[model samples]
Target: MKRIIGTGLCLLVLFGYPMTVQSQTLPVVQRFVLNVDYSRFWQNDSTMYIEISTAVYPNLILLQQDSLGFHGKVELNISIQNKSTGAMVYANRYNVPIHLADSASLVRTGSIVNNTIYALGSGEYHVSVIGSDVLDRTRKDSSSFTVTVQNKPDSLALSDIELCSNIIESSDQKDVFYKNTYRVIPNPSCVFGSTSFPLVYSYMEFYNLNTNLMYKITAQIVDAKGNVKKQRAHLRRFSLPNVVDVTTLNCISISSGRYTYEVILSDTLGQVKARSRRPIYLHNPNVKAASAETIVTARAEFEGMTSDELAEEFRKAKYIAQSDDNNTFEKLSTAQAQKEFLEKFWTRIETEENGKSNLSRSSYLGRVSISNQRYKSMSRAGWRTDQGRIYILYGEPDEIQRFPNSGDSKPYEIWYYHQLEGGVQFIYVDLTGFNEYTLVHSTKRGEVQDATWQQLLR
Candidate 1:
């Protein structure tokens, strides 16, 4: 049996799942990411429709090979309970396999999106979801949410707006939330950060609309103080009995912080009849990771460092830093702002790992030190080198296969990881005969992959 890492109540799971108020003491699991969202059914006034969407990060799932290419299995469980009566109202359990074009994409930063639809009467209920990797049973994630179902008779109403990290058109393979040829990937946390997710996609349904009447749909990103920071408006004629509206908003330029994405429906008289809101968090990738004291300290630890030294350290964090982050850091006018950015970066990662101790920081720095000592070349430092980067990002490989001066090919090496996303391999080659090995290919998603890599040996 494989060793399972249980995440009882990590903050990431808490943000995405919203399980009952009960909290757990287990550390956060960094292996996988989960997202959940819901859409309301409008066809029947007496019966309320609630469709829940769930997505599993591809990098975290374990995949297997089949005639179709590569795929990973995920076991899912979902349930809804009446909060007032503590009665179970809806429940379901199923399994899904995510497929990819090739092995290298398995480490990519996308997700396998799946949605489930449930119809129930008007009431308040708690929704719960659990997802486990079938091949790696020890790795599982779950979430719980509170929802209400209410459908009034023949009235002009709008359902809750579904927020998504991604939305695309699908040609085949029907699933729930497939409307007008588009599939929406839910962003349960409603948080967009780093560079991986820079767009916010929204979808909603409007019912009992007078097709002849003109209405305005407005979306705004507001701060906690009730001030609108960003807004967009759309004027439409509800020609159909029911209207499904979808919109895409650019969030890459949004500042890092807390905010809410709200949608409001208004008539010609400028009266707000129906409105829905979802909380959102924007992360600033430019923030660097560093050690510092709170305000109590007169001068910060990073305050004394020179600009060149600070830039060098931040550069070493390339494995985790985003392109936008580097661009932002380069434009900073003052050292204080740079220090503050790094502080936030470190704090965010620390929060993700559970603030129980400084073990995460120590471990990462230790790996960096090892990379420098073992993989550094004539031009680059250890962490900056290809071999150093792989070690720092994934830790030590389970096995290393070295092929020096074999046949007419250049010297090469293969690193195997037995416990990462099922299993993966990384190949490095010394193309220049200078002992500096470059990462030629990898079997992990998001990493470089070349099926004809053997040809490069010459």
Candidate 2:
């Protein structure tokens, strides 16, 4: 989620997707790079409008205090080549003055956001943007992607869906993002969920409308497998031939997944017209498990699921379950019984302050997915590994000291948790050379505390 600084909280320049590359320097800086994308709208038969937006990590550049404020300069080269003729159709080299929105980017979520518009003909073009910190050419990034300019239709038409963090109705004409009596702040990263935007907004233009006939606007959130997770529609009639439509979806309750925000235009008779779609990734970890009454209403839905499936969902959540929960769940023989128990299980957890555990089903599973990537061993699943257990149990460690193997000892790592139980350390040593580290010592109470654990490292 890339956003602007100072002016607002954070902002994105939602344009189009661009893949980034580096110039062989320490690629660690790659995390703090730039995002460049473009959205195409039909302008005329001979040309189309390519609206390009760039969100840059200011930390990647060197800034100096100037009259305007703390700012840096960046060199950029953008080119669009005709794929059919192997010739460059457009190319430009310029310097963009990068301004610091608020403070240092390291201390906040901020980016240098800017937008540009170009007019190109209807065809397939290969677009590329190469940029560098002007004072430090060695720190550079490049991106290239394909852009397809579609021809305009004579009937009702739709433009590319522009996802936004906000849509403000403003009368200021000089605003950088002002459009159609509104300001559309683009979220080019195509991301939404917890800790950021709980609602995703869309801005689009509809062309060649039938002013005399009534119309319908249908909006849907579709999954990867083409299943519609959510749908909404509204009836509208326009006095003008074309109009801009903006819609929003409450993404708070939608589960974490990859989805498509689609908008469809239909006539009063339910005849299909125009449609537009944009990809979105949502991570809604803060959504609480269903409430007591909500669970009661949904019990029948859960009972429709197989008893085995319901048990598996319970099993995956066993890390936080009580001893009695396991006993009761294991004895459930029918789907109805399992569904009732599952409802109670979630409802009870919604209020429990068990061990200060603050977890939603989405967040817990999210950590499990992350652990699988960080601690997977060859012999077993990552969650079954010793390190995975500590990670899932205690969250992220404050510090880690990794010791490589030498003649005197095997590779080992000591994880530090400063705030838990008055500061504790867990030590894992790779007795085997296969990177399978085993937990051998801990300073925490009720755990292995072998003073001679170093001897085993040998």
Candidate 3:
């Protein structure tokens, strides 16, 4: 009897029918798909617009293939929420049907699609999308995005925009003042470079959100210590074409460091206007590496000198070192010889415990170091030749007049310094060889007679 029942059940299964099967229902799955082509929208007056599309898919079958089925509606809700305060400033909802042909490729496109929205005020906002399938099973989906709301011209007002580094105590509670929008480029903390620094500002339209006109713009530069170093109020008439264009306010020669800049925009009456504040940090290049050469040369020169003699030499040389060699001096085979030479060179110049070196002795050794680093030519260091002697004594001139490729006149550079007593100028000419700069003339105080160019030869 049991064999007969099992055989009967097997025959039923082979015929696509089960005799003792339990009925069970599976959960339906729904998917909501949404996408936005443009992520950013500009605020125009009280209205803002965005473009979006959404799609929905159901995992379960609701009706037979040839039968008409009740389709559910899709709901999309978009809201603009403030990013800073988490406040919902604007919200909107739209409902549409999910009706499609049984053989309509299972894809449905939304009909009532709008890409624009209007809002009031200027601030940061977010957009959210929500969807739901109104079938027997309660299935829903949601997603969100962000947008920025900017102030229009009509919503802006010019008031006493006083900008100060610190708050001031006053009798009136309404005396609180904030800074106007102003930015300094290549911030004070920045090192000098080929690029120029700029200061930028913008104006807001008062009570009008659509107005793009910005009013009176002025910029001021303060030093790292918060002291007003430079002020340019004439820029008040300047207007920016766009918010991003305001970065053109950068200035030149703004040293690197922490700096605070204030921008004031006002009307014709000089009344204070819209204000914004920004802090800037400019970075200076690592100059510590640059001075390494100076330090190394000083150490090498003072290898054998006493502390007192070293101090006197530094004072007379106006600098500590005689060579611009960044590497430490190495006297592998002739260490004693090199040490003895260095000591004799300083001992001959030491007049007293800490007195100045004798005039006959070479005191401007630091100048030699600078010239060797700056004016080397033809595989020869500047300090190894005659031209080096002049440079070491007088330093680089205020002006250098070059005679390039002039076969007859010869090439030369004129060094000028007005601070020297009686105004000194050195005329360097390439006398011995090509591309060589040699001091041929030295003029003092416009009197070419008392000059001492030949003294370098001796």
Instruction: Please tell me which predicted candidate would have the highest lDDT against the true structure.
Output: 2
Tens-digit lDDT track of model 2 for 334-367: 3555565566566556656655367655566677
All candidates' TM-scores?
A: 0.53, 0.54, 0.24
Residue 20 accuracy (lDDT) in model 3: 22
Q: Which stretches of candidate 1 lie over 4 Å from their true place?
A: 1-29, 62-71, 83-87, 99-102, 166-177, 180-182, 284-458
Clash totals, every prediction: 9, 5, 44
The top-ranked prediction according to TM-score is: 2
Local error of candidate 2 at residue 224 (angstroms): 1.4
Candidate 1, residue 27: CA error in Å? 18
Judge candidate 3 against the unseen true structure and give its global Cα lDDT, from 0 to 1: 0.39
Cα distance off (Å), candidate 1, residue 280:
2.2
Q: Write the per-residue lDDT of candidate 1 for residues 390-452, one digit (tens) a residue.
A: 898888899999999877999999999988768899999998889999998999888999888
Alpha carbon lDDT at 40, candidate 2: 74
How far does residue 263 in candidate 2 sit from its true spot (Å)? 0.6
Candidates by TM-score, descending order: 2, 1, 3
Question: Between prediction 1 and prediction 3, which has the larger TM-score?
Answer: 1
